[model samples]
Target: MITLAGKKALVLGIANNRSIAWAIAQAFHSAGAELAVNYLPDEKGRFEAKVRELTAPLAPAIFAPCDVRDDAQIAHLFETIASKWGRLDILVHCLAFGNKEDLQGPFTQIRRDGYSLAMEVSAFSLIALANRAVSLMPDGGSILTLTYIGSTRVMEGYGVMGPAKAALEANTRYLAAELGKQNVRVNAVSAGPIRTLAASGLGNIHEAIHKTEAASAIKRAVTQEEVANTALFLASDLASAITGQTIYVDCGFSIMGG
Candidate 1:
């Protein structure tokens, strides 16, 4: 029902093959969206090379460097898009991070440095990118971000990310409203837990999944591909009228009382 054929999509935050962003990139490619993906360059450049290998099959139109915490890098990234593609149709913001130590300890134990880092990269960067995206999207477009149930509910293991995601969802709504006149749509997909590399740092991530599977009405967790499909819809014309909302793709876990 939804197709993004011919749309230009830029996907940020691909850390590895297991990342939600990578999955979104694959789905976008499958739907015929011309793709460009971002990777943060580490000291050894291993991360970039790994990302390149994982994404080789798609042969993205552009593979650029982007670290959300750096403004100059982000500017260069959009500039590259402008030079190559001239316009952007879909933006997938799948960025998030927090100190692993922050995930295990009590909230009060979270350091100021860690909290600030999480908010800037996970939440504020979306605002920065959206500002850039609007300019390239004179024809209007879709802006999508990845989120989780922890944004609204208390999940002890989610720690600082819970607050960061809360801010991200809030940004989604405000951006959606502000960009409506331009016909730009912004939304977040609050997907259920997946066994991502980042999730592995959560200590008891398996227990969390088990609980989601038992408590959810569907009696199972959602997959990265399923979440990717929902994202594909949001990016396509089918969701033209939808914006400023966090669509739940959690197998009914969010609605359960028990």
Candidate 2:
């Protein structure tokens, strides 16, 4: 059994029970890893309250607010980890966002600001988080991010997020190379379409899921738990030598020829 006993894992990007990050957190917890989770800050504290209630069953050791766009919040998050756990063993990054306008319509029509926002939130945030996460990972650790097949192939309605995910995959490789000396592993998990709140923004999400089920080798869409299991393997010593790669949990959807 792949066990993460005593390992401290920080999972970011959980929006609700349906979030892939939430599933990862649950998987990590089941594997015996100590968990820390993050929620985006809002004026009303609604996000914090929802996350706190949703994660209560798992009893995460550290639950805090982190807006990856805010350097101060990022620093504070790492500071909290440092004060509470001293060191981190796994960092799970499942964050991604794109404006509604940018996520549909013609790619050429994408606004500059929307494009920039997509890149910053979906791609650049990984680099920013990795920068801080490495500091807390004085010992070797795993850093994982979520990506998608749209990053490589053209997927209608995926829009600006396609390029953002492409950048994220590129960043994964580069980070893995640079951090290998420090024994830090960086990788991305490319999951099949799911009906998560974030994915609901996409125009062709239902079509994508149906097509994946009809044509993929497994003939079904991959579940959040399935993706989370891959994350669990990557986070544990089982994948000690696996890094700088995008492991697809897409029911082989990416392999079929158009």
Candidate 3:
């Protein structure tokens, strides 16, 4: 069994236990990685409280307040990691945001602020985090991000989210190519629709789930566990040779035609 024993991983964007980031953190913890978590300031207590309820049965961990959109916070994060752990072996960025108003309307109707905010927080933030993380990972590591199938295909109500995901996918490839020389592999996991707080922002997420189940080879919606497990593989040494790729854990939904 490939385990991340003795490795240190920073998992960002965990709002609660139901979050995909939390699932990945749980999986990584089970595999023996020392965990460092980051959450928004307003949500830090809730994140820490749930992490306590979840990880108490396991081991103690650190949860830091990080609004990834801030360069100061990002710089401080890597500095803290360096001070505490010396080096990082993995960084999992699962942060994304979009205005509900934009999501509920047509893509052409998206407001300029909503569009820019979506791309900045959801797409460019990954690049920002990776650039800083690479400096702390002197011995080569892995950087994984979350994406969705809406990036490639049109899904109603996905709106600006689809384009944001597309940009994220493109950024992943470019970062992978640029960082490969440094042995810092970068990849994205294009997960299927999982019911989370953020997914509720999409006007028709439930309908999308039903449609995916009807068309996918599995004939069922994917779970957070499935996505988390794939993320574990990519973050582990088991996937040493893989990089600059989008691994879809969509229950074969993307393969469906018509």
Stretches > 4 Å off in candidate 2: none
Give the C-alpha lDDT of model 2: 0.94
Candidate 3 residue 202 C-alpha distance from true site, Å? 0.7
**lDDT tens digits, residue span 143-209, model 2:** 9999999999998899999999999999999999999999999999999999899999997789989
Q: Give the candidates in order of TM-score, highest first.
A: 2, 1, 3
Encode model 1's per-residue lDDT on 156-257: one tens digit a residue: 688999999999999999999999999999999999889999889888889999999999999999999999999999999999899999999999999989
Question: Sorted on lDDT, highest at the top, how do the candidates line up?
Answer: 2, 1, 3
What TM-score should be assigned to candidate 3? 0.95
Q: Name the weakest run of 10 consecutive residues (lDDT summed) in model 3.
A: 51-60
Better of 1 and 3 by lDDT: 1
TM-score for each of the candidates: 0.98, 0.99, 0.95
Model 3 over residues 161-254: C-alpha lDDT tens digits?
8999999999999999999999999999998888898898896888889988899989999999989999999999899999999998999988
For each candidate, the alpha-carbon lDDT, in order, equals 0.93, 0.94, 0.87
